[model samples]
Target: MIQEIKPAIWQILGKQPGRNVVIIGGTHGNERTGVEVVSKLKSMIESGRLNIIRGTLVLIHGNPRAIEINERGSEPHADLNRSYLVDLLEREPTGIYEDQRAREIAPLLIVSDVVVDLHATNKPSEPFIACADSSGHEQVYQWFPSKKVLSDPNYVLAGKLVTTDEFVDAHGGTGLCYETGQAGDVTRVDEVMRNVINLLIDQNLVEGEVRIPSNECEIYEMIEPIVLTAVGFTFAEGFGNGSWEPFVADQTIGYHGDVPLVATYDGVVVFPKIQELRKEGSPLAYLAKKVNERKKPPRD
Candidate 1:
């Protein structure tokens, strides 16, 4: 049956007991694809057009306030996606809207068996999935069509970044983040939504035959983040064109002052911050190499 857990959160509890599934959208507020997908699912359930049969399905609107204003975040410098750390969730509420949302969402994630947080990029880029390398994560992500998987098992982003997926993973759940390409693009919505429904069916949370993708995923293990320095930084001419753009050894990713930031091995730059979003003390971009490309390639 359909039930509202909060203003923007809903629960569809199945009669049979099974895994606790949580799906989140609008984590960035401006990423409308996820919001659209989850909202449709909620409406279907509410209208008796869709039904859950095996587990509790939680539909969450990650940041309704930001969505109302159609902005990346509800407040300046307070990203809802980056507010899932344990300390922040445990402490007295800072009264930040995102923080309070994180705290309210924490309990659901802690007991969830699977969590999928949908998102979109600010710049033009290929769609991809981000999650720690694990069998649980593999089971969920394989259902999606995106082949580029960013696996950050080491907490490489200065070990300070705690996102929704990472938070769910900490408590032994399969958490997956699906970036559905550029923020304004709606072309992939139908495809993404189909895969999400397939996942629900495959997990037996909903009744249907499962559809599986045959494409093998290319895994990129995160090496480290390129931190923006106080002197400032700039992307190389061909780099920062998009996420997952490849770079070769010694190729300059950008420059900090007059010093060049060069790659040490063949890899891709992930999540390069656009000029307007660039902030010092935070990652300007992250360097990652394919799982098999960790060893330096043979050169003449």
Candidate 2:
């Protein structure tokens, strides 16, 4: 059963001894993939269809109020994912929903040995993993079984944004942000559940053999985010998420009315969300350059 320690936060503990792992979903209320997966897992466990042989597993719904309204955030221009700023971990009242929620959720990271922060893009795309510079700890992504692991990009980590995955990592735990798929896609729930189950098995939290994917995982580096800061920003071509086409310098991918938002360097346009209306300072898309074909390396 799911117990509510606080509003919007829920945890479930397994029967046996193991590491403490936490997985979060619904950081953006509109992203239903994580939330659905958590709920489904809860049912599966209760019905004896799945078992957690060891370790405690915590599943959290990051933005319950927003999910209640079926919007990205409950209020206009609100973002819950970026609310984990370091200074705000004090748990003091922040006067903002996302900020206050972040404070309430901070304690979970303290006990987490592994953290999986799940997310879904506004535009449809293939699943991927967003990890920090894990040069020394490169084996983390092998568990999640994603072909593409994205690292730093253009203007990556440029602002004061502190994500949930980063916070859990700060506590000396393994943290990863998994982008399941597009928000409204029906298959994202299964994708999120499958990858998370693989993580659990690889970590020995569950008693099962891991199913390795046939395709090799690849790594990419995000170089730039096409920011839609102006009122009239619109895509030149309606690009879906994960649309990686060759882009040249000064090529107009979109426009702020008549003003072209051109690429400054050569790369592929990725995670483009051209179908929705976005607030200023939000990303219209990101450009990524392929770093390499990810390979298993000798352990240090």
Candidate 3:
């Protein structure tokens, strides 16, 4: 049976022609910054506080049921971000809450020209953008405020886990997701909204002056996703998500069944989580290396 159904799609037209951009927030229930900022953007448009100078702007509340409950997904382990694959949409509508929702959005993703799905981390960490270099366009990273961008080749190699951006790209649209600060951070809402506004101005979807930053941005290429199956697994204390400490090859970070898992190269950690029992294939964390040519060549 279909659960919570919230009609949160909003489309506004501009006076002239431009790119069809879709911004999605709250793909994960616990990430309220998207919902809060999207709603605020909608109000600004309705109140004549902002104008779409060109093309069309579409706003979507990605996972309303999950957001309503203030949980990561509608149910345990059912992440909406990882449920946008084409196979799941076509053959697994009844699979789970996330699958069902994916079916509802698969078509919409194709029609939009540019898509930005907003999300926030579970714990307090720095903000960043996660995109695939294969997703198309170098400027996609510039549209956000985060100075750090992650291009995970393994995520593409894993194949099964297709994010909203990848799914959108398969359908011929450019898509990317922005990871804001912690989900519960009070400043998250404003920061996200400001970034969205900047994107609008930068993309020329709205009319305004935007100060594109001259500050340097860094690119991190995800080398591997650390799979956690051991009931008892953890990293060294103080080593956590959003960490960018370099380690010599073979330095121990954690262990599995008495087997020490060491760094394969000089790398940094991302998305460190401590779970008593992690489902198989669950990425406990990711190891990445800073890259200079993030705009050129697919990650190896």
Score each candidate by Cα lDDT. 0.84, 0.72, 0.73
Candidate 1 per-residue C-alpha lDDT over 1-300 given as tens digits, one digit per residue, 9 for 90 to 100: 788888788999999999899999899888889988898888888888788999899999999999888888997666898888856655888788898889888889999999999999887788899987665677788788777888887888548658999988888788989999887677877788788888999899989897566656777889999998899888889988688889999988889988999977999988876786778898878999998422122231
lDDT of 1: 0.84
Q: Residue by residue across 1-300, what tens digits does model 3's lDDT show?
A: 111233667778787989888889889878888878888988888888888888888878888789899888888777888887755545735658787777777777888888999988765678888877642534565656776777775673245657898788778887888888777665778767777788788788877887755535577788887787645456765565444555557888777756777876777787665353246767777788887543343432
Error of 1 at 48 (Å): 1.8
Tell me each candidate's TM-score.
0.94, 0.85, 0.87
lDDT by residue (1-300, candidate 2, tens digit) is 557778756666667778888888888888888888877877777687777778887878888898899787769767777777665665567698888778878778767888888887776667778866464335456655466777663336435537787766667776778887787665767766877788788777778897655546566778877777665666667443355656778888777778877767776777666444454787766778777774653443
Ranking by lDDT: 1, 3, 2
Candidate topping lDDT: 1
**Poorest stretch of ten by lDDT in candidate 1:** 291-300
Off by over 4 Å in 2: 133-140, 143-145, 153-158, 211-215, 229-231, 238-245, 256-259, 274-277, 297-300
Residue pairs that clash (backbone atoms under 3 angstroms), model 2: 147-217, 147-218, 153-222, 153-223, 154-223, 154-224
State the lDDT at 298 in candidate 2.
40
Which 10 successive residues of model 2 have the least lDDT summed?
152-161
